[model samples]
Every structure is written in structure tokens, then in C-alpha cells.
Target: MTLHAIRDCIHAKKVWDLCVPKRWRKHFFLTQDVKEWVRKNITIKGRLEDFEWRQWFPIICHNIWLAHNDRVFQGSLPSHQDTLVQSRACLAWSSLVLHVSNTVAMPCWEPPDEGKVKFNVDGSLDVTQNLRGCSGLARNHESMVLCGFLYRMPSGSILSTEIWSILWALKVAWDRGFRNLEIEGDCVVAVNVVIEGVGEEHPDLCVVQEAQMMLKQDWRVNLLV
Candidate 1:
């Protein structure tokens, strides 16, 4: 059988394999008894199998195998039935990579001639379990352009969301090629995290730091509460 066929077999068995803990996967794969059980109980090929299932099998199987071997408890393992879970993870990973790329990417706006300044603004959503709302904005001093307010639904008070908004603003500024930017935000916590270089205190601040480094090339960041 081709590698694709083997992958299809692995995908077909993923639901059962997911129930088996990470520590047990290697043992399950290597154990002769388990293999016999799989062969007897799990059919690899048949007209009943759909083509989409075959296509998805390799991706799911590869992730499961990596999950088992890596054995890092970073977060709760998603359910096997969550076929799109890996796709979500891939999107998040891609966002992170794109974030990094955009940080170093060329300045979207040129630095204003001497004496001219560019401003970038952002807002935050501060909501508790019971309260929900968002606050932030961006503006450029050179262009005198002000960005509108950012809104959030219920359960938004978490610090991570604010930091994420700041990063988003930076990306916008970078895209506009605005050099000499003054970044403004309403979140004191987010501003202090960037100003004081307290990344360890707020693990999420790493994203802000990366954006700051990128902005340093042609822009200056100003934190406003």
C-alpha cells in the first residue's frame, strides 16, 4: 500500500486512539497484542470509506502521533471528534508567524519629514464575568487621522485581549507605513507591561514586545492610558 493508504488506516483508528492516553500510544502501537486487536477489529479499506475521510486521515493521524510523542501538556487535548481542531491550531500558528513577519515587514507608512509625527492608537475590552465592554483607539499626528473605537462582548476583562488589541493596532500602523508612530491605548496594564518591559509578569506581553521591536525600525511607540 502507498503511504497515503497507511495514513488512511491511521486516520480510521484515530477515534479509538485518542481515548488512549499519550503515554499509552507508543505502547499501544508497539505492542503485538494491540496491533492484532486493531487488525482484527479495525478495517483499513473498504468501499464504505469516503474520499474526504482518506484525505483528512493523514493530517489527523500525523497530529495525533505528534501529540503522543511530544507529550507536552500545554493545554487540554481536543476531542478526536473535533476534526477541525487541528485546523484551528494551524490557523493560530499561522497567525503567530504572520505576526512576526509583519513586525519585520517593511514600514507601511513612510516617516513624516522631520517635525512630523505619526500616531497609532488602540483600545481594550475590559469586562468581567458579569460586565462586557471594549475601549481603545488609534490616531496619527501627521495625518490627524483617528481610528474608531473597538468593541467587545461579554467576558472581555481578561488582560490577554487588551494586549492582543495593541498588537493589532501595531499591525495596522505597520501596514500604513507610518513611521514615528505614537501608539495610544486605554489599558494601563497593557501600557505598563510594554513600558516596563515586564514580559515575564504578563506572558502575553511577548506579543507586544515583538511588535515593539518591529516598530523600532522606523516608528516610536507612545503608551497612553
Candidate 2:
């Protein structure tokens, strides 16, 4: 349901809070109560293109359902750490999907110079789940597939997946007896990281560093774009 429609559901019986016993709150457990519950109507105002609500509401609901299921089936309530991990995973997936859908597309894959393979990597976050997949394909100048691979990763930001795609593609090319290669991706931020061999201080720094280190390995003058 749209967030506006959920106002009644959030306020009437506080279905979200039904499971949290008063004793739990007496201990001052932090709660996710529809993000600012009040007696007045929620405006739900934002920029037309902004997707904050769509991205965040699902995380809250997913965590709540997960906690419920764990308590019911496993006879165990999720810890704060568990809730944070699940919620972050969901948030990462949402961010990835929004970035991919909004990414501008190239007309079609272009062939690189002869003797050099064009490695194109694309990443898409699974919209309905906390998973991300990246596809990397190496094609010769004749549009022949030298090698290709897809890697499924746990929930993370799109930049991390993009960086991983590059790393995996490089390994695939080296294994397939290709040396000269041109790596390409739609994410300018990720591409720049490969070219500069560095990334800003962020959670994705580890993967970015790995990809850069892989680039230093003997690969016969690979180009990043």
C-alpha cells in the first residue's frame, strides 16, 4: 500500500507495535513507529522523482515480519544487530535498484579495437529481495563472446557490485587467455575508481581496493572506461 494509505493502519491499532509488549518498551527499546506517528494526517510530501518512502517503508516492514517469523517459528526474537543487518540489506538493495532503473542506457554494446576484448559489466539489484547480481561479458571486435560470467552477491551498494563485476571480469579474461582488454560500465563513479585506482572513504572501499589491486596484476595494458 502507498504510505499515505498506511497512515490509518499505523495509527488505528498500531499494528506495528502490537507485538512489542509494554514490558519491552519499559526497558526503552527503540521502535519503528511508522516514522513519526502523530494525531494529525501525514502529509507525505516530497519531490516527484524522490523515492525515499518507497525505499525505506519496505525495509521497516521486512524487518518487522522477519522478527515476527523468527519469534513464532524459531522461538527466538531477533537481536538489535539482526534487525540492523536485515534492514541495511534491504536498504542497499533498494538503492541499487533505484540507481539501475534511473541509469541512462547506451544504444548497444560496442565492439572494441581488434585484438582487444571489450568487457562490459552491468549490475542490477533484485527489487523484491535483498540480493544483487552483476553480469560481465567479454566480447571481441567481431562481437564474438570470448567469455562471460554472472556473480550473485549478498546485499550491498551498487558501487560494490560494479567494482566486483570488474574484478570478476578481469579474472575471467586472464583465465581465458586474453590479455589486452577494455573494461566498461555505466557507473561513472565506479569507472573512475578503476581508472584512478582509488575510491573515497566509504563502505565500498574494500571492494574498490581489491579491484584496483587486481588491475596491477599482469594483464597487458587494460583500459578502463
Candidate 3:
């Protein structure tokens, strides 16, 4: 999963996970300009899983260039409103494709079965602050809180946090004999991996395998989000 891209310009933008400087924004360059810059700029690459959102990068850049050209040569025929309307349509389609190919649907929190317990788990890693924490709480169908705990985990990749949080929660539930369990987490990838079971070649194989072994108990477990 080698995902590579060259970031040039879109003006200084503060977006999720990035803070682009003012002088580095795009210059309304043509495809050739983009291509040339990509060739010259550093090649940024990452695993396909982690960098999946980048699949939309080229298309987004193309649209930006088209909008620039239309404003300069077409006399802004498709005004800002028109541009936004078209963009929304394109975005909806792209989002669907992205979801189907490599993503999972986000889930909303809900209660478990009548006799079962719902375990809500979450992990956070503040890279800038070097803080990492994981927490889990159990609730019953009647909206009664049962047990919960918060623990500090080592700072690492998002996968680490996701795996650790759920893994810890599972252990707690198992020890307490909370057999019929519904586990929920915001990390869909981690949720799916735990639900479907992990493979030998996976990066977090050891921890995931341990979690899988734990899931084989006499309890019925379900994972979401």
C-alpha cells in the first residue's frame, strides 16, 4: 500500500492534521504545472490504509485548477454558488466510493440487549502535547452505569491507541463475567479488525491476536464503530 502525493498549494489552509504555510498555496497552475511541481517536490508516501483520503487529492487539485481557469477566461460563468453546488455533488459521489472501497460506516451510540451490557471505549492521543489515554465504561439497557476505568497508555500510532483501548475494555468485561457484551469505538478500522479477527501479517498482529484469543470465551460479543 504505497500511497504517494505532492502537496503544492491551496493557499495557507488550516485543515485536519495539517497547517499549511501562507507562501506555499497553489498558483492556479495548469496540469503541466502541477505535474512539473510534483516531479520536483519531495515525494510523500504512506501505507494505503493510513493515506486513503489522499485518493481524492488529484481530483481536488483538478477542480481547483478548473475553477481558476473559469474565473480568468470564462468570466466566472459558474459563480461561487454554482461552483459550490457542483462541488457538493461531486463530493457526495466521491465519499460513497471511498466508503465502499476502504472504509466502514460510522456508528451512533446505542444501548445493548435486555440482559447484555454495553461497553463504550475510546482512546485519544495528543501528539502536540504528548498525552495518550484510554477509557471504558459499561452501561445496561436500563441506562444504569455499571463500571468504568481510565488508563494511560504509551504514546504511539493511532492503531496502538485503538487496539489498546478495546483490548483493555474486553479484558475488564471478561474478568467481570460480563459475557453478553457490545463494544463500541470510534475507530472503524480497529472495530472491524477486532470483529473480523486479525491476520498474521498485520502490523499489530501480536496485540490483535491476544484480543482474538480473549474473544473466544463463552461470551457473545459484538463490535461497532
Q: Give the runs in model 2 whose Cα sits over 4 Å from its true position.
A: 1-106, 197-201, 221-224
Clashes of each: 12, 0, 4
Give the deviation of candidate 3 from the true structure as CA RMSD: 17.1
Worst 10 residues of 2 by lDDT: 39-48
Question: What's each prediction's TM-score?
Answer: 0.36, 0.50, 0.50
lDDT of 1 by residue, 1-225 (tens): 222222224443565464434554564455345445345324333221212323333444455554433333554443454433443233332333456577776334433345434333333332333543333333333542333223344444456666656666666566645555555544687777665665467565576687667656666655555
Residue 46, model 3: lDDT of 28
lDDT assessment of candidate 2: 0.59
RMSD of each: 16.1, 14.8, 17.1
lDDT measured at residue 182 in model 1 versus the true structure, 0 to 100: 59
